[model samples]
Target: MSDVWTWPARIGVLLGAGLFLALLVPILVIQIRRYGTTSPARLLGAAALAVYGTALVAYTLLPLPSGDLAAWCAEYGYPTVQLRPGQIFADIRERTAGLPLGAVVRDISVLQGVFNVVLFVPWGILVRRYLGWGLLASAASALGASLLIEVVQATGVFGLIPCSYRLADVDDLVTNTVGGVLGALIAPWVLRWMPRAKTLAATRGEPRPVTVWRRWLGMAVDAVAYTTLSGLLAMAWGLVGYLGTGQVPPDTVPLWLFASVLSWVVVFVLPLATGTGESLGQRTVWLAVVPDVSRVADGGVGLSWSARLRRGLAGGALWGLLQVLSDAATMFDVGALASASNLASWFAAVLVVAVPFTAGKRGLSGRAAPYRLADAREGAGALSTHR
Candidate 1:
């Protein structure tokens, strides 16, 4: 009995963790783009949904035959389909006949039916409350999803497996759907504290105050994006080289150099050339670099391509140079330069953390450039007013 629950739980947790990690960046990007900010409740709900999804799959379709599929199917001589509804009630009654109420409730058949219903309750709550779907739509969706799961089971995983390993019962469909409808009915109370998508979208374009934390978040995104791009490029080059030449390259200097250049083009050059004056990460997090007009007699207007490029270079050059040197040292096995690069990288991090505490909240880069970071939506409005 413990094995019945433990195996599925373990599988679900492991798969769900992997799925969450894969979706983290995309989830952040989507939240910022759609709502202009992140919500802890929404992120937690998303994580819960991922876990529930994997758990559902694990429960419904796991414990597949290991070997001797035909023999296993023959040994498990249960009906693949149970079309008659209310069979669950009959089974429960037969199994728990003349037993005490407590014993009856604890009966295996009764628990099975209850578990199926409980498993789908979250589906209804998430669909109806989090997604803001109508009750009818949520209920229909739950029924459809339950039907699909049963169908897949009855069809032996869409004919991949030789035969159905579990019963596909009409009773399960009814119970699951009922659970979904019940959940939808109570979702408003359950998720009273959660922000609705509609509410978030309504204020998405409104200007938000620039904060040190927001600045750090944008920078973190930039670092992660740059590192991921460089790593992927290097891996692709290595893969291609291995396929064509039939040997893995011994030296990685060429690959790292090529990757660094391409990543720079993407992370730095593209934003400036497009006149957005924001890195990919900044744009994703709803931040932008705008001209500082505090000293000008007349306020500054929008930045030209050349002006934007100059500002970007000034703000990013030191850290970018350090990154390049680090890559070079790594590729060439230059121990001294690697150590220097590591120290510089730490120093750069300290500056990023410390600068926000200083007057004007300008980091090392911001002080060097004629521009400062602003919320993209707010910055756009400010720029337009000046124009």
Candidate 2:
């Protein structure tokens, strides 16, 4: 029994970590765009949901036979499909005959029934509370999910394996559905403090002050977006090269350089060229750059393409230079270049952190440009009219 749980627990943790990392940027972007700010509770809930999903799969269908599938099935005598309803009660009674009520409750057969129900409780809670489903809908969803799991088990993962390794019991379906209903009933109390998605969406258009934390979050989003874009471009480049030449390109330096430049163009340059004056990350976090009227000669109204480009370059020049140096150092394996890149990286990080504390709340980028960051909810016309 302990072994049964230990393996599943390990699998759940490993898969959960990978799932969390993969979903982190998407979650952050969604929350910021929908809510106009990040919610700690929502983030935590998302992380919990990921873990629960992995654990559910781990517990229900894991620890498959490593070798000699037919021999293993014969030796272990895998159970057949259990179609009888209320079979759990009979199993419990038979296993704990002549025992006290407490002993019966504690018996392995009874505990198994309880565990099946408990395993799906999180599904009910998440669907009802996080998903905002009605009780009936939540219960039905649980039934469907449980039925699917049972079908998969009975079919040996849809016939991938030769035989079912776990029992597909009708009693489990009943208990799991009951657990879902119970969870739906308790969901309100369990998630009373969680913010409603509707409320967040309704206020998403309202203007918010540009704060240090908001700026930092926008920067973080940009970094993640850039990194993701660069990786994707590199992969595509390699794939194309492999298909055309029958082998992947030998030197990755050119691919890396191309990907980095293209990613920068998409993430930063395109937005400025289009006159939005916002990076992908800034847009996700509801921020935009508007011309600072005091410094602009044209009264800061409807910034021209040249002006926008200038602002973007002013803001990103130093960091962009540092990033190029870093990339060069990495690609060429030069000790002096690597040391310079490291120092520049650290300096850039310090500037990002420290400049936010200043009176303007603009980082070095903002200070360098004749533009200031404003909440996207504040229309460009309104921001341009101000300092």
Candidate 3:
């Protein structure tokens, strides 16, 4: 038990788990990009599978007993392979024939045999549950897994290490296969608690009309984009300053000022530059702004260059002011102001949703201007004007 639960081993497991989880981020991002949404059940299932695989791989290969390959090679010879059938059973019978029950139960070899069988049982369960494999399939998979381990041990980890340090036993293959078959046989009972595969697939809910939830999803994407863009820009700026001055760059501009500029660029200037009122969030949600039908006849359909500039400047100024205030409060350690700013931000976010019901389907910004929010008329990311 002490050998199994060492701190180094625990740390290895943790690092493996984290590595698996970190890898999932890009996979999830890809899934979201392709599907325009994610399924919680699929994500959770994939994450769980990754964790198990990582742990298994770590346990099988990490923390090599011998570090100095040359010294290990000099000391240890190639391991003898055990391929004879029933050899393990014969040994077990000879060792336990006259032993008392307690002694047999306490035997380390007996415990190890049991552990080998138990180790592959989860594989069978997972195969049946996640992959929907049948009994033969699970058993075959288990046999393959056992064969791979044996091959690795036989080849000295594919010649990466010095010599074969672990035993390659045929009994392990038999026991593992048996364990997997047994697990498959009992999968119905064991996996009863888990959601069905069909249910998991269905959890990716149908796409509805662009509502508050969809809008919120778009905003979430925008938030990610903003943070990523800001970080990249900051790094680039720092590098440029360092190259020019031959010293580490310092923040010459105040945090509030920097945040204000970033907010204007991210929220207003860039969106207007697209020649659409849709910010990144609105574009992702397939929303657009168009002149209200009632106001289009009143010279609201087309605005002069000066009017467009005023609208962009006004929107940018408001966003910049909010961003600056938030940054200032955070920098000054004003917790109350920071909290208030966060609340205010949420309130402003909800304004679009609330205004639709209260102000006749016009967003806060749209109503103030000459536009209203309109979703894509056609399916699959086609945006059309409200008019």
> In lDDT terms, how accurate is model 2?
0.77
Please give the lDDT score at residue 85 for candidate 1. 91
Measure candidate 2: CA RMSD: 3.1
Candidate 3's displacement at residue 343, Å, is: 20
User: What are the lDDT scores of the predictions, listed in order?
Assistant: 0.77, 0.77, 0.62
lDDT digits (tens) for residues 1-387 of candidate 3: 666635444654676568656665454554444444545655665666666566555555554556778787667645588889777777878889999999998776787688678767778888887677888888899899879987887778898876776777888889878888887888779877766555544534444355555555555555555556656666777787789999866654543345445754775567766565666666665565554556544655653345445544444334444555565566567665576467547655665355446343444554456555555334433323335
Best by TM-score: 2
- After superposition, the stretches of candidate 3 with alpha carbons farther than 4 Å from their true spots are 5-13, 27-42, 74-78, 202-205, 208-387
The C-alpha stretches of model 2 lying farther than 4 A from their native spots are: 1-3, 6-18, 67-70, 77-79, 243-246, 252-254, 297-299, 302-344
Clashing pairs in 1: none
Residue 276 of model 3 has an lDDT of 53
lDDT of 2 at 181: 87
Encode model 1's per-residue lDDT on 163-268: one tens digit a residue: 8777898998999999999989999999999999889988999877777766666666766777788889888888999999998876566776688767867876
How would you encode candidate 2's per-residue C-alpha lDDT over 1-387 as one tens digit per residue?
578766777777789878987888788788888887777888888887888889888888776666887887777634699999998888887899999998888887887888888888888998898888999999999999999998888887887767777888898899999989888889899998888777777887889888887777776776677678877987899899999999977546786578777777777677667755777667878887776777768775556666665656555433554665666677667677777567656765866776567556667656555677788788757775666
